[model samples]
Target chain A: MRVSKFDRPYESGRPERHQLRVENISLSFGGVRALTDVSLTCEPGEILAIIGPNGAGKTSMLNCICGLYHPQKGRIMYGNHNLARTSSHHLPKMGIARTFQNIELFRHMTVLNNLMLGRHVHMKKNILTALLYWGWAEREEIENRRFVEHVIDLLEIQHIRKQMVGSLAYGLQKRVELGRALAMNPGLILLDEPMAGMNVEEKEDMARFILDINEEWGITTILIEHDMGVVMDISDRVAVLEFGRLIGIGTPDEVRENPDVIRAYLGQDHGGRS
Target chain B: MMATTQCGVFHESYRSDMQLRPTTWQRLRVVVVFAFIIILPFVASAQNLRIANTVVIAAIGAIGLNILVGYTGQISLGQGAFLAVGAYSTGLLMHYYELPWPIALVLGALITAMFGAVFGIPSLRLKGLYLAVATLAAQQIVGWFVRNWDPIDGTKADGAARELSMPRALFFGDKLNDSEFAFYVVGMIALVIVAVVATNLFRTHIGRAFVAIRDQDIAAEVMGVNVFQYKLVAFATSSFFVGLAGGLTAVHSTNISFERFTIDVSIEYLAMIIIGGLGSISGSIYGAAFVKLLPEILRDVGLWIADQGWLASGQLDQYLPFAEDAAFGLAIILTLIFEPEGIVKLWSDLKAYFRLWPFSY
Candidate 1:
């Protein structure tokens, strides 16, 4: 459902979104190579899922794109800005948003506050105005609150909007995490394990929300998720990782049949190599 | 999921939901509180009014401490030093420059904020106990400067005197001299302005940013909060309120001394916020009053015990003075033991209990 609000002031005259491009990035800590010359490109509005076995550097690759990790080599570009060089703090303003593998919510605050914080980059603030809470701050807050409410509606979290996020159930927390990333109104979203440790039903719910967020907002999604069935069903393109190396990068069907992907990652259920 | 803050009450709009006080009971409570404050001077004695003024002034400082320590999750031990900076700046502006007290207070708060921001520099690189120690240096350094600096030693030329005194301020046209009732207007105004400003601050993005920085700095940073800048802003905002308290204190007594704003004084303000509630604005007021009043009440209790022949009168006199210090220690211990989240949790629990009052469900 389209959000009914027409007075989204900042949504007007928006610049065209830039495609995310990662060119041969490598990352290491001390002596351990977390990612080795990993390179991939995400078009402006496609969901690219990175599938890998445990310890296959999926999170690390997502981290590099979000500026949480600076690559030792290769250029990570989103639009014109180099993700490797730009401060992680600046990424949100540039319309880059992400959720964590382990939820990093402001635990003390309510769900409403957490979601409002997601709009921090877009909210205009002047300390004097904020001190009085009179004009610009109030206007920005109401406008943003209206926008965030639509996200709440989208995620079906209207019931728990006032609940403290820290006290919520795990599946609920994951949904709230996604809602927070969506609250950024980002052009590009990198979800690091958006659905992990959930019942099949909750997984389906999260998957549907992912699809909705991408299709409704036209947000370019770079998702790192396990659960191959869900990933293959939802993603437009799939990249396979093994031992810090990209073995295959193509459509879900293309990667499914690739001999290296099956042998390295997809062959876990079978006793023999593909 | 269908529950409401009040069983029958529900918000119809986001604007109503965003309100600081949305309920009829809360609005009435505010009006009742203002009425009580308005009637207080008439019923209270001059000495009682003086203490009330002191309590409110302490409330201002405690609120300041809460902003940094509780809300922002930035620990501060320099509360006393920041207060001294404020007190001294207010005193200096009044004595040397002949500025009016209100202007002096405003300027003093600004000056104190600068000091707060500068001392808060180490916080960007350090936190917790390390930040506490770094801020402790502010208390020491400012104390030393007050004692040693010839110029800061009030209006005395002998250089032996450490206390500074200022003439009484004229409020609107009348002199606020000698009467606690008159001086109370200044304290009340400062408290109201501060409490409102502080409460308003948290409802907006700036206040939320402080909380975000405190709760999850990395997430906040990635989510586009300038963590370093917000941290400094927290320091400055907290110090500004502390300074206002100091300025009020200056106006209340029309004098200042190093002993008055000592390390113990700093610890007392810290104790106020801790005992009141970290990050709770009202808890600051409650804490300041609790910290200030409990000791005096204990002293009275000590005297009453002596009067009632429960203890030897002369024998108790020697230790009667220690009752205040003893009360401080006891209050902290009891608060930690009974309500670790401080009085704020107790208040919330009380509200929750009443929310389902018909049964203990």
Candidate 2:
């Protein structure tokens, strides 16, 4: 659960391994600015954490990356794709999967069904084949179920496989949401407040799962978490936003010691958690 | 209650696990229902057989509506309009082109499916009651077109009626003997096929996506489900079944009119799904039976009351229709109040109560 900078072969080659780049992005709603000239890069197979106080456009930045919002100006380059032109429906298919801040598991569906839905892009059966539910459809289903089952196992949600997601506790629902994103088998995973509203035990479990997803699966992750302790321990890079501006971006240790970052946290009396 | 929940029920393989009816009791129940339906024509009178026919037709329409309004969670008040599209297309193909019944049926379904998809385009941007109102406009537009078009020659002078009859619903190169026989054979077969497809649909990837969209469109979109495409598919799939049912109705009744596919008819469909159980395939049949038969039962009650000298025949006639409509309205209200989940839940509850009798736990 500790952030080991040298355990991985990424630090020296970080710039060369850049997988996502957000440059000169400005977004607004009506007359209020949400994000302005915000820029950051996520290297391959590393956890990049975004920390900000409330109303600092942290969620809006994630929304911009996943094509939920049109930023009015700037470019979001993910590999060769421009995220500004990508729609939400196309995000997962293009290897970008995200979990919402609030749990968004399909409430009436079983956890298995919700996870299976995460494999929507992977399953290629047409309507005719789906109607038969045999041969090609059955084959595709079993193949995808193997992946979903792996996610279920990884997230330790086997006990609630058949249970409706709506009836679950909030922490379990959040885990199911992460399992859903994992089931997508994406190259880049965007998790918004993955450990929000969890007890210490649940938060520790989530932190471990996030690390496992990033290290073991080689999946690039952009995480937004309020627990500075967990963020400092897990993240390879940290970006700080305040009042719609990127005030600092660096390694967690470097960002933590910056005077501007210190002043920003103290200005809000945010307990130096940032 | 724990007896059934115990871990004795076993599936030996993946194929068995995916079975629609995994338990012997469920299989037996399905067999018994089909057997009873197959044997009903011999024991029942022709009039009663026609009622069965109507239920079968309505059940197909109800199942279609359920796919849109139930599984997909899209509110549609335009199901009847889609039915009209099927009926008219099939009627025209039969009347002018002289196509076979099967071709006409398939083509009619496809045409109505296209119309349904077109009407569904607005659904991505609109939802809930607003979407319902937009679909209501579809109903109005279709109704107006059918009433005023007069494309074929069988229009009555009043313009309200059209002699939209099937020459004879030919089954395996043999003509159906009568309307009762048609319902017994053609309608029953259609119901079985549609029920099977509709039941299997919810088990597949596409069906799950539809349910996901219904539960939460934003989450479905984020999960790689093309919400817009799936919603359109749901509308088209629903209208296909309704249109096919409409084709069956056109052939069985040998007459068609704009009044048949009115807003009231669409609301009746909504009631059927709600009263039957929103997301259950078999519930659609229960709902269709309840809705289609209630008016007949009420009319009989009204007639018996008049015969008992409680009222003059003229006065009874004046109020009888109102009584039937009022009874329908009351049935929906009562169903919503007592069992919002519908008759399927009620049936299950009753079964559970009986199974756990004497203990009261």
Mind giving the per-residue lDDT tens digits that candidate 2 earns over B57-108?
Answer: 9999999999999999999999889989988898788877889877998899
What value of lDDT does candidate 1 attain over all alpha carbons?
0.86
DockQ of each: 0.57, 0.40
Backbone steric clashes in candidate 2, count? 0
CAPRI class assigned to model 2: acceptable
lDDT of 1 by residue, B1-361 (tens): 2223776667787667788888899899899999989999899988788789889999999999999999999888888899999989998999889998889999999999999999989988998999999999999999889988776654655555488876788876656656788878878878998999999999998899999988988889888898888899999999999999888888777567878888888888888888888889999998999987886677778888888888875878788668777778988999988887788778878887788787855
Q: Which residue pairs of candidate 2 clash?
A: none
Model 1 regions lying over 4 Å from their true place: A1-15, A266-274, B1-4, B154-161, B172-177
lDDT (C-alpha) at residue B227 in model 1: 86
lDDT per residue as tens, model 2, A1-274: 1223234322211222238999889999999999998888888888999998898899999999998897888999987788976888888867788999988788988888899998888778888777776688887777676667677777889778878888889999999999988888888899999999999999999999999878777889999988999999999999999999999999999999988888788765556656
Model 2, C-alpha of A97: deviation from truth (Å): 0.8
Q: Which whole-number lDDT from 0 to 100 does residue B136 have in model 1?
A: 94
Looking at model 1, give its docking quality level.
medium
Candidate 2: misplaced stretches above 4 Å?
A1-18, A268-274, B1-6, B158-165, B172-177, B303-316, B351-361
Candidate 2 local Cα displacement, residue B197, angstroms: 1.1
